[model samples]
Target: MGIVELKNLTKSYKQNRGIMDVSFSIEEAEIFGFIGPNGAGKSTTIRTLLNFIYPTSGSATIFGKDIIQHSKEIRQNVGYLPSEVHYYDDMKVVDLLKYSARFHGNLNSTRMKDLAARLDLDINRKIEDLSFGNRKKVGIVQALLHEPKLIILDEPTSGLDPLIQNHFFELLAEERDKGATIFFSSHILSEVQKMCDRVAIIKEGKLVAVETIEHLTKNKVKNITITFEQPEQFTFTVDGILKREVNGKEVTLLYSGEIKALLQHLIDLPVQDVLIEEPTLEEIFMHYYE
Candidate 1:
């Protein structure tokens, strides 16, 4: 069985909203990405997987055990960072971290200190006094200190500076190298592209496409730009063309069909310059939505 599995998972609330027929699986030691825009049921799916909320229908499993029935056991090997982080106002950062670590049994003072130093977190300061970025650092430390087998992050890079974000990605890479499975959920496509092995895109509470970054960006579509000679208009149509745009003498399009077919169509056009390149993750994702 996969490390994580969901079978026709669905959740509903008033007004006919919430996730519907959501299903995917994460293999052991894989860095799987769950990506979607806000309000697309990303959190709902994560919450259900964690059993923080029950699914209206369908089911999921983590660590090869049922999510709902074995919540306690599943949690023991899981570390999670929610999109928004909150902490006790009165407790110092160190105290809060210690309190969190206590639940998982022995404390790893050395690892805690290392992570704190790497993140430039002031563990001595009160949680209330910390900046949003600092609080996020706390969340990172809390999630990783346990060294859990599965690490789940929901938009975890919020409030972090670019330099720190780079460091955080490095840490995650180190964890992955050590055989930890990661389920990273984010709306930021570039980060997901940079970090995950495979990605599952969700739109409007439904699974859309799941594929590797390379295949999604390279194999699926090619961005074509054509510039024609003055006074010579160029127009051609072929299958698998999307998001076509024209600006005076230049035309841009996303082409996903046969390259030979596109070449055949382009042969008759009044073409002066033509450029073809791979599309970005955002472009690919938008194509899926379209």
Candidate 2:
């Protein structure tokens, strides 16, 4: 069985704005991305898997066990960072971290200290006085300190700066190297493409596509940029040409079809330069989203 599996898993809220009949599976040691725009039910699907909210229909399993039936037992081996961070204002960062460590039954001062220094967080400071970025660092430390088997992050980079974000991604890479399965949910398409092996595209509370990063980016799509010898007003009468644009002596096309046929068409034209490449994740996602 996959490490995490959802069979038509779904949830509905009173406002008619929740996930609908979503289904996907995550393999062990895989970094699976759940991506969409804001208010697209990315967080709702995550909440259901974590059992923070019950599902309206269908079912899901983590570590081969039902999420709701064995939530307490399952959570002990999982680490999570929510999109929003909140804590007791009066508590010191160290104190709060220690409290979370108590559940794991082991506290390594060296590990905690290293994590704080790496993220540029000050444990001596009170939670109330920390900035949003600093508070996010604390949440990161807490989530990773336990060395859980599964890591679930919902927009974990929201409050971090570029430098700190790089450090944080490095830490996640280390965790993956240590055999952790990651479920990363975000509306940021670039970051999801950077860290995930496969992605499931969700839009407006509905799942649209699930594909490997390699497949999504490299296969089934080609962006062609052509510069003709002189200005020409010609039409693209080929199959699978999704979009076409023209300038004085240049033409660009977003295409998906047999390359041989495309090359055959280009051979007879007065082409001076031509470049064809695979499109980026964002470029490809637009086809599905809009």
Candidate 3:
């Protein structure tokens, strides 16, 4: 069985829409990226899995146990970092770490200090005195200190600078290397591209697609740009080609299909320059949504 499984999970609140007929599984020791725009049920799915809110229908299981039935056991092996982190203003960083550590049993003080140093966090400062980015650092430390088997992070890099983001990736890689599974949720495609081996894209509270990064980019979309020796006009008949723009001898084609066939047709033309552009994640989603 997979480490985490959502089987036809459905949820709704009052008149607000939530996830519907969502089903996916995450294997052990894999970094899975969950991508979706706001109100696309990304947070809803995460919350459901964590047992924060019971699903209106269907079910979720982690580690071979029902999420709600075994909530306490599931939490022991799970580390969560939400989109926004809040802490008691009077609590110092060290005190916060110590408090969180109690829940997960015990952590090595030396190891925690090392993690703080690597993340450039100061343990002496009170929570209210820390900047947004620094508070994020504290959240990271708390989530990871006990070394949970599965880490569920929702927009974990929001307040971080570029340098810190890089460091956070390193930390994730290290955790994966240690045989930990990470399910990271974010609307930011670039970060998902960088860290996750596989990704699941959600749109309008539906599971649009799920595949590896390579498969998503290589098989899901295509890019074609052609430059002619002289200005010539031409139109493509491809069904999935989303956009076409012509400028002088330069022609750009944003298409999705077998490139070999597309290239064969293009080669016959009096072409001088050719450029192929890969669709961005946003572009890919936009095409599907429209």
Candidate 4:
């Protein structure tokens, strides 16, 4: 069984749309990416999973226990870092971490120190004195300090620098190696491509596609730009070719299918140079959305 499951989950507000019949599962120790555009019900789905708000219909379960009925127990084993983090301005970093640690029992001082050092987070600074990126670092520390079995991060790398972001992913990988399941939600495609084993894409309150990164990329249509030695007017006769353009001696074709036929066709032409570009995650979704 999966560590987390959402079965036909639906949530709606008066005159506003929410997630519609969304369902997906995350396996233990897997890094699952939840991707969508802004206001695409990403946060709403996460809120329901955390039991912050009840779903209007359907169910969500963690470790075979209903989230609504066992919210407290589920929370104890789950760590979350929201897209926007709020905290008391006067509290020092160490004090805040200590307070958060109390909920899950004491944190090992050695582990705490190591995390702080690795993240370049200063424990003595007051929350108000830290920069936005530094404050985000504190939130990251608080989330991982409890050593929860499931970590749900919503745009966790938003305010972080590249160096810190790399270190943060390393920490997440270590936790996953220790058998923790991670559900990461973000609009940043590159981050998801780099860290997630599989991705679930939601658009306009509808779940669109869910597949491993490899499969998603493999199934995406390819754009080929071929420059012929001389100007030649030719039309693409392939079944899967979605688009074709001819500009002087340059021919651009957008197609989806096995490349063998396309390669043979190109070999017969006086092609000067050929360049193939893979579609981006956004481009892949754009095709579906259109």
lDDT of 3 by residue, 118-140 (tens): 89999999999999999999999
Per-residue alpha-carbon lDDT of candidate 2 for residues 201-256, written as tens digits (9 for 90 to 100): 99999999999999999888899998999998767578988888898999988888
Model 4, range 166-258, lDDT digits (tens) per residue?
999999999999999999899899889889999999988889988998877766588788899999877648667767889999988877866
Clashing pairs in 1: none
Report every candidate's CA lDDT: 0.91, 0.91, 0.88, 0.88
Cand. 2 TM to true fold:
0.95
**After superposition on all CA atoms, how large is the RMSD of candidate 1?**
1.1
Ranking by TM-score: 1, 2, 3, 4
The better-scoring model by lDDT among 2 and 3 is: 2
Sum up the clashes in candidate 2: 0
Off by over 4 Å in 1: 231-234
Clashing residue pairs in candidate 3 are: none
Tell me the spans in candidate 2 whose CA falls farther than 4 Å from its real position. Answer: none
Candidate 3, run of 10 with poorest lDDT? 234-243
TM-score of 3: 0.94
Per-residue lDDT over 1-290 for candidate 1, one digit per residue giving the tens place of the 0 to 100 score: 88999999999998856899998889999999999999899999999999998899999999889999999998989999999999999999999999999999968999999999999998999999999999999999999999999999999998999999999999999999999999989999999999999999999999997898889987979999888886445456788988788888888889899988888877876778889999999999998888
Residue 290 of model 1 has an lDDT of: 81
Q: Give candidate 3 regions above 4 Å deviation.
A: none
